[model samples]
Target: MIMHDAPEQTVKYLSLLGQQFPNQQAVFTEIINLQAILNLPKGTEHFMSDVHGEYEAFLHILNNCSGVVREHVDEDFGDTLNEEEKDNLCTLIYYPHEKIALVHAAHQDSPTWYKRMLDQLITVARRLSSRYTRSKVRKAIPHDFAYIIDELLHTHPDENNYRVRYHERIIDSILETDSTEEFIYSLAELIKVLAVDHIHLVGDIFDRGGGAAKIMDRLLSCVHQRTDIQWGNHDILWMGAAAGDAACIVSVLRNNLRYNNYEILENDYGISLRGLVSFADRTYRGGERIDPLMKAIDVLLFKLEGQIIYRHPEFDMEDRLLLDKIDLEAGTVTIGDETHPLITSDFPTIDPEHPYELTPEEARIVQKLVDEFTGTDHLHSHIDFLYRHGSVYLVSNNNLLFHGCVPLNEDGTFASVNCEGTWRSGRDYLDFCDHIARRAWRDHDRDALDWMWYLWIGHRSPLSGRNVKTFERSFIEDKATWIEPMDPYFTLTHDPACCDMIMREFGVQPERGHIINGHTPVKTTSGEKPIRADGKLLVIDGGFCTAYHPKTGIAGYTLISSSRGMRLKAHEAFRTVTEAITHNADIRSETTQFAAAERRIMVADTDTGTKIREQIQDLRMLLDAYRTGLIKEH
Candidate 1:
């Protein structure tokens, strides 16, 4: 084989490509296919942040695509279907098996109802499928009923009475075969897949709520749509614990206990907390008082954090080592000029000489907890998925998605952080931390594990932009001492110039790019806006966690970017999935139009489109080489 004169790299790339498509005809066909794909409308992307283990709300949003399914229903059958029919149809699409059971219980004529519902589902599916190519739609169809779905979707009964008979015959055969349940399930799933092209979970998939494990299971089992998770501080805490970090294990347990989520550890992940309970009961035995036990655990956590700081002085978190400053006899902790009374001086596990040292009992309990965390197959699988699909930050489709701030100095410049004696700032700093976090699990590196602990509470960590203030919140009574100032990035993010710098640093076009972030909840009740920097940055964490609902006054915010443009939706609280299925209740959402494109966006204008364009170029070059007689057609 011969080739035209080209650069060495180009020739090498083309030679590799030729191995797959060796003939001119194959190259031409691929080029044509790519061209056709480039002409299709861009797929919809759904963005939600700070789920915080609210699995019902999260699952409901995912199922209905932040109310996109309802919008599609309204658009497709605005006058044909009334509100009640639309609500029932949407519920069927959301919880197919459950809704079907309810329908069977309620309806006297089951067959007639099934046929009517099937017809409605087909109509909705057809409307959703219109945006995608037939090949893509076929791939999304369940394998068991692939042929049947393809036949139904392609054949139009309205074309003629004969076509109507054809459609009726397929439904009758399914009923006769007793396959209606399976068919309904497959169709509902297909409708969900067709509605949203991709899901972006911005951060905080763990903590507060009790259903993180359930949510993880749902995401892991997703086959049709794609999902990417931006690791939040809460998520990283659990990931570090799963890697067997002692401090992280304590932090996770402390948080779970504080939220009254012991069942999540015991029942969900099979993590036994009986040893900790026994230890706590024996050490702070006083009429089942949780406050004393909580104080003891909080002190233990501070000491563990101090040990990490002591090990790495470069972390500059010595101010957080408050155990040494506590006078156990006086029952007080001295900070700066102020000495505050301690709530409880019941830290029996803490040693005065070696304040950060874990006592024998505490050490045993920690070891058992670590074992429980890392030994559980379900927890391991969940963390493995996080490592597999999650990143500290993501740049996709001209947008930056991250869980927290980019650490910045008071003077509005990127803060230089020391990582193992090397100073890094901006994107380089985040990349360094991400590398260590993965290595903590993959290589079982001790330094990496310590760094994971550092990322949890370090002053310079982007995940934790402010001091944790756990000790201040627990021991100190003064409200002034409880203040944990946010990083300057939080204030500077409101400035368009600062946002432009961040966008440029991340290699995204500043004019069109946006930074989508979470971690801090948006207090809508207090009249706080999620959109910042005049639309250049967006903080979409409207508090999906029920604990934060009091402050936020809303369930959450979801950003939907489609062919038309981007829209931000504020959702009210979801009562329960049972209420949704039985009562046909959906989350009441208020949507605001953020941006609308002058022209509809196509595949050629997207990130995926860029990659397809490159492939087309290579194919064209290959075609030219074959025609020029420089390369053999075979």
Candidate 2:
């Protein structure tokens, strides 16, 4: 056993652990189990970022494990299955129920087809389950077919004729009972479960696309797979809105409206936008007034944001307060010596003397919206999931996952930002923000809710490095004023030293660790690569949102890290799910090997492996104590 800090510490811990183990046999059994687990292959981790509410695309990727299923099919079937047959099998694995229906409709020999498909599924399931322990696989198996799957997966036909007969008996029984469909579905799900051990949603699960709620539902249902989310700026905005922050609510509404995804608000979460919609229609009713209505909501969002800035002076976001600078008479807003023409000058709700103050009607609309945001049960449950399973950043298995920049200054040092009253930077700042975000949800503190709003768009907010140029982009004609300078972190990402500094700051090994970032979509068409700092950092937001597909020229990126190595999969834009189902069209993906290890990584090399080793050490000490008579065995 490796020597620890002190022998006395081990003695103390053994005394405590003795209560559970009680005997040498118990301690030895645990040690044996842990030792066996350490030799198992490390499970694959699927890292996705900037989903932006493209539920169909996101769900498809999750269902297919970013083409891992097809890869497995090729590996297992080889020349036996043709390309078209493989595609059909892959689709069945992804959408089992639908694919089964399609197969039934197409084939007249139902019994023969079911038997053949079942054979193929068991083959795939057996290969997928090879990396995991029998105990783990048994736990993943559906309760109804637990014994049957266990027998099939473990009992090899080559072992003996008896084993072959046993497997055939199980298959024959399944077919006789007409349980083929249920068994196939269970096996497909088990294959998916074994394909990826964990899912890392780097950020931006909401916005732009129409299916954030659907995506969340999928995540929630995957009980067997461990999932973690790093909160993105867009996610934080919605979180703040759910906490009843008016600024956040207004920002969410405006963003949804801009993307023509109002259904996400009204239909998905059941948040009533009737009051705001009515106000917009009634206030801006002249010809060509829809644009004017959007502008009014945009202005209201700015005012609401300004109110938060006013309340928190230490946020250093005074520059974002542009509402008071609008010269309604000139039909222009002067920004830094440039007076740009407004897209729409009508502002029936703003008070020029007190521009940030919402008029009675505007206030009523905002209050109603806030009530809907806070009162909705589904929104609360979704936000609760986010708070429970997410953070501003996460460091897992030597990789640093975050939604945005680490908030760096021009000098490439961590930029300090006010967290409540105290200033923090780097990991400290992120930890504080994460704590406050959870507190905002748990206690519903007004101060924490405001901070969440700050995190949504504040200049120093790591999640929102660029100033949200909502006002200027909406009202100003000059594109120059609309420029929101990116935080220096984005530019510094190419520097190995900068990447090392970030990794070290987050307490991960600079040489071995990687910073997985999202938010800034990688414009691959513009020659911008996702890999930075010679592969030490990866910016993986490859335009999951259709709004960004034109700019990014790709669907998105999924970084798959398994026992073998790490690879980045760049996918083309996904067509509708209907097309994928009807035509068996899969998202075309190109895989680029990012990093490959000299040897396959085992469980002993993983974070969980570290814990298992520690437990083994403790058990050893307990055994020593028992033999030495220092602790009596039961």
lDDT digits (tens) for residues 42-71 of candidate 1: 999999889988999999999989999999
lDDT of each: 0.88, 0.87
How high is the lDDT of residue 461 in model 1?
A: 84
Reference-based lDDT, residue 319, model 1 = 86
lDDT of 2 by residue, 9-107 (tens): 766777899999999999888888889989998999999999999998998999899989889999999999999889888898989988888777878
Q: Cα miss at 530, model 1 (Å)?
A: 1.0
Work out candidate 2's RMSD over C-alphas: 2.4
TM-scores for all predictions: 0.96, 0.96
Off by over 4 Å in 1: 1-12, 157-164, 285-292, 628-634
Name the top lDDT candidate: 1
| TM-score of candidate 2 versus the correct structure, residues matched by position | 0.96
